[model samples]
Target chain A: SQTIHQWPATLVQPVGSPLSLECTVEGTSNPNLYWYRQAAGRGLQLLFYSVGIGQISSEVPQNLSASRPQDRQFILSSKKLLLSDSGFYLCVGTRFSYEQYFGPGTRLTVT
Target chain B: SQQGEEDPQALSIQEGENATMNCSYKTSINNLQWYRQNSGRGLVHLILIRSNEREKHSGRLRVTLDTSKKSSSLLITASRAADTASYFCAVTDSWGKFQFGAGTQVVVTP
Candidate 1:
């Protein structure tokens, strides 16, 4: 079965702290990877997407960045966390011809 | 501006009743999809309707897409308390970029 894995289900960090969240997919090859942030009581905002290794597209220019180091590995990182970055972060993998599946998601609380 | 926008920021319904939500997009799409997200959980894709399709159903869920109007609707029949969650509409463009709207929070009471 196709599955996506996200690490550090929840995180707490003070403003200005560095951040790193990882996501990996299994049972799929060359799947598109996407990063999204969801604010409380609001819809998801697309942050970044990767179509292939070393190629990334950012939807919003913010304090975060995404990298695809491997075919199945995607990472979201920030040099300094901001209070506004406190939100639920989700990793998604999509089959080129079909719908996307989500990882369990990482909840970041920047105080 | 976001590509898709869901109507009714919130909704409430009794168990066994039906729940419906609407989504409108700003541009033409290759397909539209609906997703459900439980509190503190990742989102689950519920259904997808292609631009060439009109209506599709999965169990008790029905989705209708009107490409001409750039709108879609999701209907859940016999909703249960467990169905309480946020429903989001996402659109995929020809390039496969997904854009989502603010979700509609559905509360199904027992």
Candidate 2:
């Protein structure tokens, strides 16, 4: 089983502030990692996904970016935050490619 | 978009009743999955049915897939209040890209 850990369970940031959310995986090596954002009462929007170290794919054009510094570590960053960024962000990890295990998630409120 | 669409956006039912939700997708998929999300928490994977599979069961969960209709259904038997949450259906294409539905909000009252 793979476990994903995310930091700063809840975050409050002002517009234009820099943001960095970290996600780390345990019990799995070289797992695929994903970052998704969900607005209140909406479906998840895939922000980024990584298949390996130093490789990241952006699903949508936005202020957010992703990095996989290590096999088990994935990071979501933004140089300048926007009010639209406020939402619930989720980090997911998968080994077999079909089933995904999610982290507790981070609630970001950008004012 | 390849996102799935869930029907009857919301549902309310009493405990011991059955809750069924339907999901329809736009394109062909390699597999379809169901997930549960409690308020203010991450989503948990509940079940997965491959394109070749028409039906599958796990404990209280029953999933049926119809490739021809590009749709799927999830049924929860003898529901409990604990089952109150948002349920989402995700479709994975052969390329491994996944798209999730807006979700069905289910309220199981005790």
Candidate 3:
């Protein structure tokens, strides 16, 4: 069975601070990875997706960026956080079909 | 502009009653998927209906798709209080980038 793990389940950060959220999938290789953000009472917004190592696709333009350093490791980072950057961030991995398996998610609060 | 749009942003129903949500997409898709999310949690995959197929069922969940209309519907039978969650329809286009709808928030009262 494959499982995904995300770190710093919750984070509080000041404006203009650097941010890093990590996501790792166990038991899968060359899996499709994606990052999505959800605002309160709003639908999920796809931020980025990675098809393979060193390949990242940005769905929406923002201060945040995503990278897949290793086949099973995906990361979302920002050089400077903005108040609007605060939201619930999710990491998902998919294999075989288009069905995505999502992680618990990390709630980021930018004050 | 969103690719997938779901009707009825919110729905409230009594337990044991059936709840149905509809989604429509603008462009062609290779497949369509439904997901459920509890508040403050990651989305859980419910079902996936391929473009070639019309209807599919799993347990108490039923999904129907109409490629001509570019729409799909999800029906939950004998709903329970635990069924309360937000349901989202995601469309996987030919590009392979899955786009999600605004979602329907279902509240099942016991």
Per-candidate interface DockQ score: 0.58, 0.49, 0.53
lDDT of 3 at B9: 93
Return the candidate ranking by TM-score, descending. 1, 3, 2
What are the per-residue Cα lDDT tens digits for candidate 3 across A1-111? 678899889999999999999999998788888888998878888888888999998888888988898999999999999999999988888775565677889999999
- Ten-residue region with minimum lDDT total, candidate 3 chain A: A93-102
Per-residue lDDT of candidate 2, residues B1-110 (tens digit): 43799986999999999999999998878899999988757788899999999999999999999999999999999999999999999887776666678789999999
Q: Rate the local accuracy (lDDT) of all candidates.
A: 0.90, 0.90, 0.90
Instruction: List ranges where model 2 is wrong by over 4 Å.
Output: B14-16
Q: List model 2 lDDT by residue over A23-44, tens digit each.
A: 9999989887889899998778
Candidate 2: interface RMSD equals: 2.2
- Docking class for candidate 3: medium
- B72, model 3: CA deviation in Å? 0.5
Off-target runs (Cα >4 Å) in candidate 3 are: none
Query: How many angstroms is the interface RMSD of candidate 3?
Result: 2.0
lDDT of 1 by residue, A1-108 (tens): 579999899999999999999999999888889899998777899899999999999889898999999999999999999999999999988886466778989989
DockQ for candidate 1: 0.58
**Candidate 1: docking tier:** medium
List native contact recovery per candidate, as a fraction of 1.
Answer: 0.48, 0.39, 0.42
